[model samples]
Target chain A: MNKTIIEIVDSLEVSKVYAELSDPQSGGICVFVGTVREVTQGETVVALEFETYRNMALKEMEKIALEAVEKWQLNKVVIRHAIGAKKVEDPVVVVGASAPHRDACFEACRYLIDTLKERVPIWKKEIFKNKTVWVSAHP
Target chain B: MEILLFGIAKDIVGKSKIQFAAGEGQPTSVKELRQTLESAYPDLGRLSSMAVAVNSEYVRDELILKPGDEIAIIPPVSGG
Candidate 1:
């Protein structure tokens, strides 16, 4: 049976996502976790904040997960993103996939994160000591 | 009509949501809404791109809008 898990939560738990991706029929599992970095272009980032239009974000995430499953024939898929302020080294996003083979799961995991970033309604802000910048708001 | 704003759009609009009265010459389509917003807040016009969501789904500018529809201004997204 194929399973899809999508969530937008206050915090991200990689372990929970790992559990979700574990499938009895799958032999390969691949996961990707996005973290908050302390620096960006030499600016000291104090923290990173994420916000979303929750309803729309969930709808879009479901669309991405479905597409990955179809393309890669994945047995399981997990896509979760964290909202609110996150300190450096904190996990902000986790995406994973399981398949009968290694290549399919790896490709699907990449597709999940890349497509989510392009189409989802989530936004991120970078906080510094003196200012805050909304990521990718401008050219 | 009420429109939700997020990210820098919220910062530019100074609120997370905005409403238009019944007789306020409200926009009837996504394209018109974009024009109305750009004229009201020029800074929004300078962004790399902008998209609108109607009832939680992305729609083209030609899509007609209704007063009771859920609308949102989506600035360039930067999510992982």
Candidate 2:
């Protein structure tokens, strides 16, 4: 409702978020992507499964956007996180912010991801051939 | 009274919306609500950890609940 102020998508296509942030009026657009690496805490991760209480996840995401806007007085923000199964090298989370200048965009985008990691209700389970671990929080 | 439920809390209860009586002159705290939840639905007690938030702000057990306030019971999860 606020000029596409924030977009949350549950898809694997994260590059589109970059394209959306490339508006001419926005002098600064910051992007952050969280990818699935081959290892975590010395263990090789075969794949990762992300789960969310959909309704509350969305609410928490929106809350993040609102807080960013209020805190930095930014122009717009976008956050997208992939759900279900994701393999190595796949992009799992994407966050972007666009503003009149670069510093605010970068700061706000970073804050959004950091706070979202701490506050959002999404969960991830790492799957390996020999064992599985449920992570309670992201480092 | 409206109770804010999220994540594992919603899953255990099988519904996102929860309602309870707010008796006259009795205010509910986050801890009390959690105890009530564990009593009413035993499965929630098994969760690893949970944090309570009122209107998107995390608070301690002594935080009082108000009618119509959004509440979220956050369970720790590994996510980015």
Candidate 3:
């Protein structure tokens, strides 16, 4: 089994994540990155604060990686998410998938990101100029 | 049993870990645990949704809890 990397970090480096997915056996590698947005709805975002159930987040991420590989026949999967305070435009999450074919790699990358957002035990708080609110908390 | 809180749950409870004694029913099942928590801390009931995690995985209503299992409350997650 190829090494699957999953981490909840304070900061995310795109170059480092790309370097980790260097699997020569795999012919294709696909990556997806999520960044802090400058605006949320009609309000301007000043920053973002992330909270995570670290242990569960890691376990869920590993589970996601395993499921992606099993479903898409992927060779390697990397899932990383940032926690703590982050300025606008900072990287929030990164997902990389490597496989023998481009189709599997791309599909796995999308599936991993979507599943992570839905299932992982991590929360994001949006900070505006005068207010701070939890994402999805509003009606 | 002690339960760890995150996100909005932490804010509602005003602490990361909350301790409470088992009541008359001493609900061992997560379904009963939810009622116990809501009764103790009414703020938890206001949340749009919340879930219990045992041993780092979300379990269904029927899963019974051991005395010393890693337990935490998960509010609606919104990670990227």
Model 3 lDDT per residue over A25-130, tens place:
7999999999988977989999999999998999999999999989987778899999999998899999999889999998999999999988899999988989
DockQ for every model comes to: 0.92, 0.33, 0.73
Task: Give the worst 10-residue stretch by lDDT in candidate 2 chain A.
Answer: A1-10
The collision pairs in model 1 are none
lDDT of 1 by residue, B1-80 (tens): 89999999999999999888876678989999999999999999999899999999999999999758999999999998
Model 3: how far residue A113 lies from native, Å: 0.7
lDDT of each: 0.93, 0.76, 0.88
**DockQ, candidate 3, vs. native dimer:** 0.73
For candidate 3, give fnat to 2 decimals. 0.72
For every model shown, what is its TM-score relative to the native structure?
Answer: 0.97, 0.72, 0.94
Candidate 2 lDDT at A58 equals 76
Task: Tell me which residue pairs clash in candidate 3.
Answer: none
Ordered from best to worst DockQ, the candidate numbers read 1, 3, 2
Candidate fnat values, all: 0.90, 0.44, 0.72
Candidates 2 and 3: which is better by TM-score?
3
Compare candidates 1 and 3 on DockQ and give the better one: 1
lDDT of 2: 0.76
